[model samples]
Target: MKPARPWFSAGPTAKRPGWSLAGLPTDLLGRGIRAPEVVERFAYALRLTREVLQVPDDYVACYLPASDTGAVEAALWAMLGQRPVQVVAFENFGLTWAADVRDHLKLDPEVIEAPWGELPDLSRVDPAKDVVFPWNGTTSGVRVPNADFISNEREGLSICDATSAAFAMPLDWPKLDVTTFSFQKALGGEAGIGVAVLSPRAVARLDTYRAPWPIPKVLRLQDGKGFDRALATGTMINTFSVMTIEDWIDALEWAQGIGGLETLIARTDANFAALSDWVERTDWIDFLAVRPEIRSTTSVCLKFTDPRVTGLPAEDQRAFVKRFKDLLEDEGAVFDMEPHRNAPPGLRLWCGCTVERADVEAATPWLDWAFGEALR
Candidate 1:
């Protein structure tokens, strides 16, 4: 039988195997945000996050409001003016940040962009400019193959939106100055909260440099003259959902139980391998990310290359995606496997750590069936 709920949404992906609402902590449901027990659980989540991600001791990991969007904006609002900025965009989210820099922050940053499923020229990045880009383009399924493209002797900082890459892929902490992700991604936790990890250099930037514009209270890491150490130590800027915090703790514990980061990455890698094996034998489909090295193991995206589908107009191609996905959903074979609304017409499957390899394996044959049915 097919899995009961094959949640393949890019964010809020499948929960860890054997997870249920019954496993959550009940005592903290109605407690105040500053309750002693609540505070400890929040801190524990931070500690477990550090351990699971193997963050450097010199870095600080903190919870922030508004998911990954807030975290990225916070970094932008706090740090963009200290140096000239370079915004690298390969997909929608990257483009969003670039727009934020150019239009919102009004920084007039140098923009480096590429078509979907490709990467910008890394050599074009200047060390004197603060660099902003997504480590993994969730919509495009293209990831930076490695940190080698970044200069070790560079004077500028690397601020990465790692919403989809954090737990499922290996991150070189020494190479990233500010990295942000939401728990809803790889960990399969509840949404509305984001995790931001800052290197010592980033902390120094916050303490020393200030943006020329007014920083909102929610986005401020430092007051006019002093840094707010409390934000890094679990005193959040606003009231966050404590139940969501508990859910995140549950997810982190689940990650630790499964042998931590290496195990999580292996699971994602295995799932992607299973899907790739099937894709290789299937003639009608191909990866959106043409390069094997940069293909995302998390949001694995694919395009239908067969003439029957590609021959159609863009609108009809989108309809084909909807019909195919609907067939899978109707059969209970899959769920939320649709490509991102702004992405090119294709299928975007979540092969994150929380997803079971057996389920992915089972779903591939059904995909073949659905494709045939949709063409009819």
Candidate 2:
């Protein structure tokens, strides 16, 4: 039987169990975000975020406009020109950032790229130059295995896009200068807002260095000379949705109630383990990420390795995926399990903390059924 709710989408993922509109603070609905009541709630949300993520004491967590993309672009536009940049691109989002630096920023960055399901060689990264890479590749299901590759004695900063890995995986705060994620990812909160955590070094860069290009008002994190400290205190650059703020707070509270980050990680580990056990027994499918250490626990990408399926043309393979996914959806067994268009034709199921282990266990048999049906 299908779970009560079938939501395995990657972004804007399933909300916390037992979530409802009634739980939101209705009194704060009509009030302005800058109003005292709403501001206090927003501030509390930031505090909860810090506590839940266990961010460092010197780090500043700020709410920014747009989802992870906004926070990422703001950091790039504000801080890329300080030194030579090394960009690691393995998947779509990372490639997008590289394109921004090469085409939009018009900077001659040294870009290192790897094919899908693999990571760039981290040992070759130049620590003397500023570096940007996604800690976890949501599209490819590969992640940086560890932060040991980063040099402690480096002169330049490390800017990490950790949208999918923020709450699910452990982050090395000391190794990262700038890290960005959205409430919509692992937290399963409402979208439209991003959270940027900056270290003291990143703040100093903002205070001392300026990008050569023009900075828009919305993306500016500093005044003429000094960093805008208010942005870290729930003061957004543009108008934001108060309801979304409330939902984020609710999600944080739910995380706390469920034993904080450790519990969340454990939940995801169990879900991934369940799927891995199923995959080990199932011969037709296998992990897209070739290396076990780099495989993502949250966004689990699987590829069809069955000779019958692999023998088909590219278009037929895509058709197989569509048919398989459609059959699952039609049975109300699952939804939003389709791989990204640019990704290989397969399945990408979100195994984040919001997902239950039992659901993953139950869904495996359904996946087998769908695959068998599609083959027929």
Candidate 3:
């Protein structure tokens, strides 16, 4: 039997298990962003963010434009260049940050990099240099197991691109200097906005140092006298959609109703367990992440392992992936299961909190059926 709801897109991902377009609040749809109630909604969203994510009391959480990409770029533009830098690139987004560091920022950072399925040697990266890395490798199904690599005593800050991990996994808040995430992923909220959390040290950096190049208003963190503290408290740096804010509030309310982070992580883990059980039973497929410990529970990427499939030429392998996913789509067994364009030709299944474990269990047989059909 096919799963009733088959949304598996990694981003702008599956909505909450019971979500309905008609259920989204529209009372403030066309209201001004700065109107008192709209502003309060924004503040409430931030508060819910901190409470549900268990963000540290001292860190300042602010809303920014352009989703997770904007939040990461804003941090890069506003905070880097005060000292030496390092980038741990194991996936596309991290690599993009590395590019910005080298090509755009024009800074020769110590680039600690690895291929898609592996992580860079954390021990090799200098602790005293400002470092940037993704907590969860959204594209490759690899993730840092924990913050054990971060040192408590270090001169520089830890900038984390936590876009995909925020609500699904535990974040070691104290060790992270600047952390950013999109509500679209883990929370199943609308896109086009992101939340950035700044440790006191990061805010101090904003107040003390200035970027050599002119920072765009959207990316700028501070002015001459002091940091833009108002943004930290709920003021947005740019015009925002109140309708999106309501959607965010809806998601946050659902998260809170379910008993918060522990529940969210449990839900994600349950979905992961269902899919992993299927993978173990199937001989033709295996996780893309080489190490079991680092395998992502959210975006579970897989590659075919059968000799005949693996023996296919690179282009053919890609074509096979397309045909397989297309078959599933046509059958309504899955949607958006194709690997990222930059990632290796494989399958990337979303097992995020919003996904029900039963759906994942119901969907795995489709992968087997599609593989056989595509082979024929």
Pairs that collide in candidate 3 are none
The best candidate by lDDT is 2
Quote model 2's TM-score: 0.98
Q: Compared with the true structure, what per-residue lDDT tens digits does model 1 show for residues 1-376?
A: 6755578899888888888888887988888888898888888888889999999988998777899999999999988787899988998999999999989888898889999888888889888789998999999999999887678887899999999999999998888999999989998988899988998888889888878898887787886665677777787888888888888888888888989999999999999999999989999999999789989999998988899999999999999999999999998899998999999998999999999999888888888999999999
Worst 10 residues of 1 by lDDT: 223-232
Point out where model 3 deviates above 4 Å: none
- What TM-score, computed on C-alpha atoms, does each candidate reach? 0.98, 0.98, 0.98
Worst 10 residues of 3 by lDDT: 218-227
Which tens-of-lDDT digit does each residue in 161-257 have in candidate 2?
Answer: 9999998999999999999999999989888898899999899999998788898887888876667899888777888888898899899999999
Tens-digit per-residue lDDT, 1-376, candidate 3: 9887899989988889787778887887788878898888889888988899998888898988999999999999988998899999999888999999999989999889898889889887677899999999999899999988888897888999998888999899888999999978987888999888999999998888888988889987786666898887789989988878778888888999998999999999999999999999999999999999899999899988998889999899999999998999998899999999999888999999999888999998888899999998
Q: Report lDDT (CA) for all predictions.
A: 0.89, 0.91, 0.90
Which stretches in model 2 have alpha-carbon errors above 4 Å? none
Ranked by lDDT from best down, the candidates are 2, 3, 1
